[model samples]
Every structure is written in structure tokens, then in C-alpha cells.
Target chain A: MKLHVHIKKKISEFSLAVDLEMTDGLLSLLGPSGCGKTMTLKCIAGIENPDEGFIKLGDRVLFDSRKKICLPPQKRRVGYMFQDYALFPHMTVRQNVLAGMGRRPDPASADPFLERFRIADLHDRLPEELSGGQKQRVAMARIAAQDPDVILMDEPFSAMDTMLKWELEQEMLETLSEAEKPVLFVSHDLDEVYRMGGNICCMKDGKTGNIISNEEFFEDLKNGNSELLPGWRILPPER
Target chain B: MNDMVNFLSGLDWSPLFISLKTGVVATVISFFLGIFAARKVVKASPGVRAVADGILTLPMVLPPTVAGFFLLLIFSARRPLGSALYTSFGIKVVQTWLGCIIAATVIAFPLMYRNARAAFEQVDVNLVYAARTLGMSETRIFWRVIMPCAAPGIVSGTILTFARALGEYGATAMLAGNIPGKTGTISQKIAMVIQNGDYRTAGFWVAVILIIAFLIILLMNVVTARHMKNIHRY
Candidate 1:
């Protein structure tokens, strides 16, 4: 699958202009805070409307300013995993997953996703009863149950501690590998970008700078190229 | 003590029933209307939201007698809305039980609206965006996600609204009037007995009102504590 996006939006302090093209596999949008990484994901998900330009996923035109066609998020079939997980506080794990099934949600149909995410036992428990890691699993499970065309995640592990972040990242890597959908992950941490192991789109000051493979990113780092770094000065790799 | 018992036992219990009926009906009407208005106002532009909020909350800020006067102007049988209602549906608001409900609802509605609005605003907006991406409709998200998250504030609002409606005196007195068994609430009953120099009956009614108010507040605290426990569970 291929996803193409070109969009511009102006907030009070900065104007976001992002153009990205991705093929099937994991892709990371690495940037500092307020560099428009999350805004790009929001635009692709159809949550935030762009001032100009078009977004296309495969054959479907999700948004086109020239055509005056902007599909709502529901019609776009794009799974968005929020940083906070955003699990419905009132719903149990099973019901939360079922809510993502759209119009005629069947409880039994969500069972496979629940089991796949290893949240089968937690089905009857509300979101308030779950741990942070479990909440993330449920969020992923809910998205998986939807079976969307593309997945956009905005700083999914930023809330967790280092230990939990590592554990959840390993879990997420496994899950994303098995899903085989085009995934766009946004993060501010360079270590997370490297650990995610994908093509990296470096963004700075609300603009996309470069699209490089993970290998090229590491090579650039080793070669002491500071252009890829946004605000922070380039430092030697800890490893 | 005997005098107090005699006074309580011989009291016209219709005021108790009338007050509860009026409070329940008014609270129910304000509950839905307040939440709906709050949601709409919250989504409006800042200027429109401020205007709407000011208009809605005017009754709560103003004296109840002023609210009563406005109600009378709108529903006084000779007025346009009052005449239209009476002519079409035979519904009368002037000095009727319906007037009591209308007055109580108008006076108590702002509490629910303000509380629900604050609660809705305090909710994590990302949760709404996430729900939208999950293909949940707006209505579904409001009920399933937003309502549950705002329960504590809404519950407290409901309690305050019920209490205010139950104890409505100035507005109910002016709009509904103290008509023996029809529109006479506990507060009106107390006032009526006190004016007639019957301190014993007025004291009993005051005690009853205090007990009811305390119970409502207690219920709210219990629900709030339970909500806190749920939050801590995660």
C-alpha cells in the first residue's frame, strides 16, 4: 500500500507544511515538540483539516482542497493510536474493542483481537482498572479490530517510564510486524526513532527536512552530520 | 416534645409530596436540557459561547423573584406563549403545578449547565479525537465516553439542582402561588405557617427540609468517593 500526503496548516506561532509518501512498512516522523509531527498525523487521520493540498491512500482520495473533497475521519478508515491510549473509561476491554467495529458491532467478533493482544482476561475490566501497558494493548487491540487501511500513532510511548517504554516498544514492534499495514509513528526521541527501525522523516520548525532509511540515519550520525538533528546538537551514540 | 410530635403528625403531608414531585420533575427537565445546552455552548465560538452562557446563567445570578417575574411575563395566560399553550393544548402555567416546575427548572438549570460545561471542558480532548478515529459517532462518544468521564461533576450538579428545586420559595410563591394542596411546597408551607404564627409547624418543616438536603448531599459525596476509588484503581 502507498500513502501520499501534502498539507499546510497555520497555527498562531508556526505554519505546518508537510509532504510525505510512504510504502508498506513502518515509518517514523522524528521531530522536536511543536515541529508539526503530530499535526501531520492528525491531518492524515482527518482529525485536523489542512489549509491546502491533498492526501491520498492507495486509490482513495481522503482529502483534496482543489476538489473540495475532505472525507471525515470515520470514512478514511485510518486507525489513530493516541499517546494517552484514550480508552473509554466506562467501557470494558471487550466493549472498547467492539466500539471500534463500526455500525453493527458484534461482541464475539472482537474476541480474536482481544486474545491476540493478550487482553482476553481483561475483557470485563474497565479502562480505569488496567495498567498503562494493558491500556496500550487494549488501544492497539481496538485499532486492530477496526482493520483500517493505515495506522497513525502520535507519541504512543511518551507517557511511560523507561522500563515500561522498552517493554511496550518490544510488544508494539511485534504487533506492527504482524499487522502488515502501512504505519506512521511520530516521536521526538531519537532513540525511539532508531529503535522503531524504519524510514525516518526528520522534521524541524514545522517543515519536513529529509526522508532517510534507518541505516542512513545511523550512518549520518556516525559521520558527524548535524543537519539531521533539529534543535539539539549532535552527540556521540551511547552504544 | 409532645407539642412537636402533635404538630408533625397533624401536618398536611401534601406539601412533602408536592415538593418532591416538583423537584423530581424540574430536575429531570433541567438535567437533559442543561447538559444539551452545555454541550452546544461549549462547541460554539468564544463570543457566542459567552453570550449564551450569560443568558443561561442570568436566572441563577438574579434574585428568584426576578426569574418569577420573567416567567409570569411569558406564561401569564394573557401572554402570547401562555395563550398559545392554553388555546392549543389546554396547558396553563399561571399559578399551577406546571408553573412551579417551570420556575424551579428555570432557577436550578444553571447549576447543571455550568457544572456539565466545566466537566466537559476538563475532559481530555485527545479522547474525543481518538474516539472519532475509532469510528465512533459523535453521539456515541458523548454518551459512552464523555458522560461517564464527567459523572462526578454532573452528579454534584444534579444534587444541587434537586436541592434548589425542592427548596424554591420566592419564584414558586410568585409564579405558582400557595394554593393549599395544588402548588404548595415545603418551603411555601413553612412560610404560610410562620405567617399565621404557627412556629411549631414551621419548625417541623424546616427540620424535614434540612434532613432532605443533608441526605442529597450525602448521596453526592458517596458517589464522588466511588468515582475517586475507580480513578485510583488504575
Candidate 2:
């Protein structure tokens, strides 16, 4: 399936303009904070509105400014992993996992997701009781339960420490690759882009300044000249 | 025999039972109305907010007797709505069990509105957005997530309302009057017994009500503690 987005909006604080034609695989939107990365992701997920845009998920015209067609988030098939994971504090992990599924409580799908996350034992625990990693696992399970066409994650790994971030990053890559689905994940970390990646778009001034395949992205970074980059705050050690 | 005599004599059994029933029913009705009013007020435009804010806070400021006069006017046969509710419906609110409830509800509205409003506001806007993203309809989100998360605040608000209803005196006495078998509540009973110089009976029931009120306040404190504990850990 192919997904394309060309959106423009003028808000009070800032404005956003992005154009992307995407297919199946993880595509990390790399940008510094306040670059409107999250907002762009929200627009694609149908959580926010863009002033003008054309967004097509495969043959489905989700949004087209000229035609003035916009789909709300619910109608759009999008799996979102929020920054805090946003697990319902009141619901047990099991209940949270089963939230998207309708009435009468289906255990058939829930059991496998709990097993996949290795959170079967944590089914009874609330979000507060779980560690950061555990919460992410539950969040992932919730997304899997939703079973959307495109998975959109905004800073999902930022809450973890370095070692844990790397470990989780690896797991996310392996998982997404096996699924082979279109994804748009946002992060400020370069190494994370390197680890869990397909294509990279470095954003600046509300637009992507650089778009390249993974090999070219890593080689360009290895050359140690970041002026070609959009908004790279950290430079790697010499050589 | 003396202990049994004291135990039996100590109870103003009728008023005690009436007060409990009145307090519960009043709190429940007002809690629902308060939630509805507060939600309506919050959704109203800024201009409407000021008007509703003033109107909502008005019942609290006026003396209970003044408020009673207002209700008197409200339920008076002159008014079309009041006549319909009382005459056509066979629902006699003046000097009846329902009038006591109506009085208590008016006083309890502010507590319910303030608490329920604040509880509902504490819900993270982001979480609600997330729920919408998950394909959950607005109604489902409210009952499933919003209400459950705000349960502690709702419970605290309910306790306050119950306490307020239990202690209601001025409006109830002025409006419903001291009909001992039907309309006389704990507070009205206390006022009547004192007037009659039945210090023994008045003092006895006063002590019972004081204990009940104190325990309710204490239970409210416990609810506050539990709410804090549950709210903070997340």
C-alpha cells in the first residue's frame, strides 16, 4: 500500500508544510523539538487538521484540499503509540489492551497479544505498577490490538534510559520489519534513526530538508559534515 | 432494664430514619443535576459562563429562608410549572417528603457542581484525543474512561453533598414547615424540641445528629486521603 501526504496549515505559534509519498516500511521523521514533527504526525493520524493538503492511504483519498475531503482519526486506520504510552491508569493492562475491540470482551485476540508482550503476568497490574519498558510493551500491544494500516509513533522510546532505549529500539525494528508495514516514527536521536529505519526525513522550518535511503543517510552522517543536515544538534566523535 | 430504657428513649427513631432517606435521595438527585448543569455551564460561551457562574453561586449566598421564599414562589399555584408538578402529577412538594429533598438538593448543588466540574477538568485532554484515535466514540470514552478515572472526585463530591443535605435546616423549615410525621427532619426536629423546652429530647437528638455529622465529615476526610493516594501514584 502507498501513502502520500502534502499538508499545509497556519497556526498561531508556527506553520507546517510537508509532502511525502510513502510505501510499506518504517519511515522515521527526524527533527529537533518544535519543528512540527508531532503535529505533522497528528495530522496524518487525523487528530489535527491541516489547512490544505492531499493525503491518500493507498487508493483511499483520506484527505484532499482541492476536493475538501478529510477523515477523522477513528475512520482512518492508524495505530498510534503516544509519548507517555497513555495507558488508561484506571484499567488493568488486559482491559486497556481490549479497549479498542467492541462490547462483550474478546479474549481470543487479547490472549495472544498479552503473550507477545510477555505481559501475561502483568495483566492484572495498572499502568503505574509497570516499569517504563513494561508500559511500552503494553502500549505496543494496544496498537497491535487496534490493527491499523499505518502505525504512527511519536517519541515512543524517549522515556527510557540509554541501554533500555537501544534494546527496545532493536525490538521495535525487528517487530516492524516482520510486519513490513508503513510507519512514521518520530525521535530526536540519530542513532535510533540508524537502528530502526528504512528512509529518513530530517525536518527544519516546518519542512523536510533532507530525504534519503538508510545507506545514504548513514554515509552522509559518517562524512562528518552536518551543514548538509537540517537540524542535527549532536555531532559524532571524530572518525 | 435501665440500659434498654435509655437506648429506646435515646432514639428519635422516626426523624433519624427520615433524615437518612432524605439525605441519600437528595444527594443523588442533586448530584445528577449538578453534573448536568456544570457540564452545560462549561460548554457555554464566555458570556454565558459569567451569567451561569453568578446564577449558580446565588443560591449559596442568599439566606436559606430567602431561598425558601424563592422555592415558595416556584411551587406556588400561580406559576404554571409548579401547579403542573403539584396538582396534575399528585406530587405535593410543599410540606411533604419531596419538599425536604428539594430544599436539600438546592443547597447541595454548589458542592456537587464544583467537585464534579473540577474532576472532569482534570482529565488529560491528550488521553481523550488518544481515545478518539483508537476509534472509540465520545459516549464510550466518557462512560468507560472519563467516569472511571474521575470516580474518586465524584465520590468526594457525593460525600459533601450528602453532608450538606443531612444538615439542611433553614429552607426546609421555612418551606416545608415542621410536619412531624412527614416533613420533620433532624434539623427541624431539633429546632422544634428546643422551642418546646424539651431539652432532654432536643439535647438527645442533637447529640445523635452531631455524631452523625461528625462521622460523615470524618468519612469525607478518609475519602480525601484515599483519593490523594490513588490520584498521585499515577
Candidate 3:
């Protein structure tokens, strides 16, 4: 599936302008902390409204300010994984998964996703009872259960420790790759973005730059073709 | 102590039962209406929210007698609404049990609304956005996620509302009047006995109200404490 977006919004201290298109592959939104990466994802997911322009997912028009057509997040069919996972604290893992299954909510349909994420055993456990890694897995399973057309992940690995991040990163890549849909992953860590091995969309001060392959992104940084941005830190791998 | 039991055995206990019934009915109504009003205000524009909040909370700050005056004006039988209800439904709010409930609900609604609003505001915004993106309807998101997360505050609010409703006197006095075994709440009963120079009877009712208030506070603390146990560090 193809996703297209061209939207402009004025936030405090900066104006965000994003225009990009992705078709059936992962694209990492590498940006500084306040560069509006998350805001872009919110606009795509219909959680936030854009001041102008339109957003399209394949043939459907998700939002168009000119026509006054704005679909709410529920109708967008877009999955958003919050930075903190945002699992329902009051619900068990199984119930949380069932929640994403749809309006009617068939409890039995949650089994395969629970099995895929290996959180079947933890289905009865509340979110507060789970570790950060386990919460991430549940969040993934919940999103997968939604069967969204596009998945947007905002700093999915930000909460975990170095040890857990490496292992979960592999699992996330495997699951996301198998989905074969347009995935926009947001992160400020250059190493994490590079490791994801997708086209990188660098954003600085609420403005997005051209989309480039992961290898070329590092090559440009090494050759000093573009100055190193402020907030994109490259950390040495932990031994 | 023997005298106190003797006094209780001879006392007209309808005020206690009436007050409890009024308190419960008012609390139940306030619980849903308060949450609904709070939700609407929270989502409203700034200008609308400020005005709406001020109006909703006015009954709490104003003298209960003033609230009673408005209730009297609106449901005074001479007024259109009062006359229409009396004509069509044969329900008389003035000097009746319904007046007790209406007075208590108006006087106690703000407690529930303010607490519910604060609790809802404290809920993480991302949880709502997450639920929406997961295809859960807005109604489901509210009942499933928001309500559970804000339960402690709601529970405390409910207790406070029930306490306020139980003690409602000024409005109940003006609108419902101190009709023994009908509209006479514990507060009204206490006031009436005190007016007759029956200090002993008034003291007994005062003690009952104090115990009820204390129990309400205890319940608030216990419920909130249990909810906080899993999250509190220090």
C-alpha cells in the first residue's frame, strides 16, 4: 500500500512542514526530539489535524483541509505505537489485544496474534505486572490485531535498557518486515535508525529533508556532505 | 449511655432513612451527570469551558439557601415547569421527597464534576490516541480506559457527594420543608429540635451526622490508598 502526505501546521516555536510518500516498505523518520516526528505520525493517524493540505492512504483520502474532509483516528485504519506503548493499564494483555480486534470484539481472534508475539502466557496479566519488553510485545500484538494499512511507531525502543533493546529490535524488525506494509518508525538515535536498515527521512526543526537509503545516510555523514544535525546522537554498541 | 439508647428507641427515625435515601439517589444521579458534564467541559473550547465550569460550580460556592431560592422559583407550582409537571405527572416537587433529591443533587453535583474533571485531565493523552488508532470507538474508549483509570477520584467524589447530599439542609428546608417522615432530613430534624430548645435530640442527630461524615472520609482514603499502593514508591 502507498501512503502520501503533504501537510503544514504551526506549532509553538516552529512551523512543521512535511511532504513524503512511501509504498510498501519501512521508512524511518530520524529527527531531533522536538522536530515534530511524532506530530507527523499523529497527523497521519488522524489523532491531530493539519492546518492545510491532504493525506492519502492508497485510494482513500484520509484528510484534506480544503475539502473539509477529516476522518477521525478510528476510521483511519492506521496503527500507532506510542513511545511508552500506552497499553490499557486496567486491562489484561488478552483484553487489550481483544480491544484492537474491532467494534464487535471477538475474543477468540486474539489467539494467533498473542501466539505470534509470545505473550499468550501473559494474557491474564495487567500491564503494570509486565516488564518494558513484554509491554512492547503486547503493543505489537495489539497493533497487528488491528490489521492496519500502515503502522507508525514513535520511539518504540526508547523505554528499554541497552540489553533489552538489542533483542527486541530483532523481534520488531522481523514482525514489521513480515507485515510488508508502509511502516514509519520515529527515533532520534542514529545507530538505531541505521540498524533498522530502511530509507531515512531526516527532520530538523520541524522540517523534513529528502528520503535517502540507510547506507547513503551514513556515507553522507562521513563525507561531511551535510552537517551533523543536533540531536541525532550515535551511541557505541554496548559490549 | 442507657439514656442515649432510651432516647434513640423513642425517636422518630424517619429523618435518618429519608436522608440516606436522598443521599443515595442524589449521588447516583450526580455520578453520571457530573461525569457527562465534566467530559463535555473538558472537550469544549476555552471560552465555553470557563463559562460552563463557572456555572456548574456556582451551586457549591453559593449559599445553599440561594440555590434553594432558584429551585423554589423554577419548581414553585406557579412557575411553568412546576405547573406543567404537576398537571401532567401529578408530581409535586414543593414540600415532597422529590424536592429533597433535587436540592441535594444541585448542591452536591459540583464535587463530583470537579473531581471527575481533574481525574480525566490527569489521564495520559496518549492512551486515548492509542485506543482511537486501534479502532475502538470513542464511547468504548471512555468506558473501558478512561473510567477505570479515573476510578479512585470518582469513588472519592461519590462519597463526598453522598455526604454533602445527606447533610443538605438550606435548600431542602426552603423547597421541601421540614415535613416529619417525608421531607425532614437529619439536618432539618436537628434544626427543628434545636429551635424547640431540645438540645439533647439535636446533639444525638449531630453525632449521627458526624459519624457518617467520618465514615465517608475513611472510605475515600481507603479506596484511594488501595489504588495507589501499586504505583506509590515513597
Candidate 4:
């Protein structure tokens, strides 16, 4: 699927003007904190409105300022995995997954994602009972059950330990690879962006700077030319 | 010991019942209205929120007598609202059971509203956004997510509201009046007994009131503890 976004929003002391387009792949929007990466995802998810812009995903007009067409988040059908996971603490794992499928969701429909995310045994447990990794799995399971047109992840693993982060990343890659939908992952960590294995859109000062392939990103690191973009840093590869 | 026994045996129990009935009814009305108003005020703009909060909380901050004065101006038989109600529907506000409920609800509503508002504000906004993106409707999110998460604060608000309504005296005296076996509440009864120099009867009622208040507060704490257990421990 194709995703196109050109939006401008002026927040307090920071102006966001982003214009980018991408085809099907895990596109990472790498930026520092408060650099509008999450805001861009929020705009696409319809959580925040842009002062002026148009966003279209595979012929669906999600938002268009000139046309004055802005669909609410519920109508957008975009699966957004929040940074903190945002799981309903009151709901069990099964109920949280089914909550995404609207009322009267077939219980059988959530089972597949539950099993895929390795949360089948924890279905009866509340989010409060789960670990950070387990909660992330439940969040993904909820999104997978929704079966949206695209997925947006905002700092999905920022709170995890090193070992759990790596493991979940591998598991996430396996799950997302089979889905075949455009996934926009936002992160402030360069190592994470590289490990996710997709196109990289380096963002700075609320604007996307360069769109580079994963191979090119590695090549830049190998050639010691990784300092080309601001707010992009290279760290040692994971053990 | 004989006087205490005599007071208990011949106690005018109507005042205790009247006070409880008024408290329960007022608490019920204030519960829903306070939650609704708190939700609205939380979503309003800064300026509008300030104005609305001030107006809603005025009755609580002012002396009950001042609040009674406003109630009188609005519900007095000569006033348009009171005249319309009295002439059209034959519903009287002054010196009526309904007046007790109205007075108690007005005096107790701000406790519920302020507590609920603070609780709603503490909820992580991202949870609401996530629910919306998951295709959950606004109403569903509020009832399923917001309300359950804010249960502890709401419970506290309800307890305070019931306590305040149960003990309401000055406003109730002005609006409902202290008619024995009718509008007289435990607080009014205590005042009347003291005025007649019946210290034994007044002291007996005071002990009963203390016991009831303690029991309710203990019950609420137990309920709140259970609810708190369901919340995530960080």
C-alpha cells in the first residue's frame, strides 16, 4: 500500500512541517525527542489535526485541508501502537485484544493473533499482571486483531531491557513480515532503526532530512560517513 | 444510666430516618450530576473552565446560610420559578422534603465534582487516543476505560458527598424547616433538644450519628482497598 503525508502544524515553541511519501515497507522515522516524529504519526492516526495538509493511504483520503475532509480516528482504521502500549489495565489480555475489534467481536478471531504474539496463556490475566514485553505483545495482538490498513509504532521498545528488546524485535520482525502492510516506526535510537531492517527517514527539526535504504545506512557506517545527518548516531552492533 | 435508657426507649426516630432518606436521595442526584459536570469542565477551554468551576463550587465554599439565601430567592413562593411550580404542579420548595434534598445536593455536589475532575485529569491521555485508534467509540472509551480507572477517586467523592449531605443543617433548616416527624433531621433534632435543655436526648443522638458516620467511612475504605488492588502496581 502507498502512504502519502504533507502536513504542517504549529505547536508551542515548535513548528512542524513534514512532507513525505512511501510504499510498503517498515519505514523508520528517526529523530530526537520533541522533533515531531510522534506528532507526524499522530497526524496520520487522526489523533492530532494538522493546521494544513493532506494525507492519503492507498486511495483513502484520511485528511485533506482543501477538501475539508477529516475523518475521526475511529474511522481511519489505522493501528497505532503507543509508546507505553496503553493497554486497558482493567481488561484481561483477551478482552483488550477484542476491544479493538469493536463490540460483539468473534472470540475465535482474536485467538490467532493471541497465539502468534505468544500471549495465549496470559489471556486470562490483566495488563497489570503482565511484564513489559508481555504487555507489548498484547498491544500488538490487539492491533493484529483489528487488521488495519497500516501500522504505526511510536517508540515501541524504549522501556525494555537490552535482552528483551532484542528478542521482541526479532519476534516483531517475524510477525510484521507476514502482514505485508506499510509500517511506520518512530524512534530516537539509531541502533533500533537499523535493526528494524527497512527504509530509514532521518528527521530533524520537525522535517524529514534523507530517505535511505538499510544497506546504504550500513554502508555509511562501514565507510565512517554516518555523521551525514543531524541527530543520527551509530553505536556498536548488538551482541 | 436510667436517663440514657429512657432516651433510647422513647427516642423520636423520625429525624434519623428523614436525614438518611434526604442524604441518600441527594447523594444519588449529586453523583450523576457531579460526574457529568466534571467531565464537561475537564474538556472545556481554560477560560470557560474557570468560570464554570467557580459557579459550580460557589455553594460549597460559601456558608450554608448564604447558599440558603440564594435557594430562597430562587424557590421562594413569590419568585417566578417557585410560583410556577406551586401554581402549575403544586410542588412546594419552602418547608418541604424536596427542599431538604435540593439544599443537601447543592451543598454536597462540589466535593464530588472536584474529586472526579482531578481523577479524570490524572488519566493518561494516550489511553483515550489509543482506544479511538482501535475503533472504540467515545462513549465506550469513557464508560469502559475512563470510569473504571477513576473509580477510587469517584468512591472518595461519593463518601464525602454522603457525609456532607447527611449532616446538612443551616440550609436545610432555612429551606425545609424543622417540623417534627416531617422535615426535621438528626442535626435539626439535636439543635431543638439542646434549645429545650434536653442534654441527654441530644447526646444520645450525637452518639448514634457518630456510629453511623464511622461505619459508612469504614465500609468505603474497604471497598476502595479492593478496587485499588485491581490497579497496576508500579
The collision pairs in model 2 are none
TM-score of chain B of each: 0.94, 0.89, 0.96, 0.94
Error of 3 at A180 (Å): 0.9
Off by over 4 Å in 3: A227-239, B1-6, B77-91
lDDT of 3 by residue, A182-220 (tens): 999999997788788999898988888899999888877
Residue range A127-199, candidate 1, lDDT tens digits: 8889999999999999999899999998999999999999899999999988888999999898888888999
Candidate 1's C-alpha runs over 4 A off are: A230-239, B1-9, B78-89, B230-234
Q: Calculate DockQ per candidate and list them.
A: 0.74, 0.61, 0.86, 0.90
Compute fnat per model: 0.81, 0.57, 0.96, 0.94
Residue B162 error, candidate 4, Å: 0.9
Looking at model 3, the pairs that clash are none
Report the lDDT of model 3 for residue A178: 98
Query: Of models 2 and 4, which has the larger lDDT?
Result: 4
Cα displacement (angstroms), candidate 1, residue B223, comes to: 1.0
Mind giving the per-residue lDDT tens digits that candidate 1 earns over B20-48? Answer: 99999999999999999999999999999
| Count of residue pairs whose backbone atoms collide, per candidate | 0, 0, 0, 0
lDDT of 2 by residue, A1-239 (tens): 78888999888878898988778998888888988899888898888889997888888888888998988877887888899988898889998898866565676668888998789999989998899999999988888887888888999988789999988888777778876678888888788888886898878768875567878777766675453363533456673
Q: lDDT of each model, Cα atoms only? A: 0.90, 0.83, 0.92, 0.91
lDDT value, residue A4 of candidate 4: 91
lDDT of 1 at B142: 83
State which candidate has the highest TM-score: 4
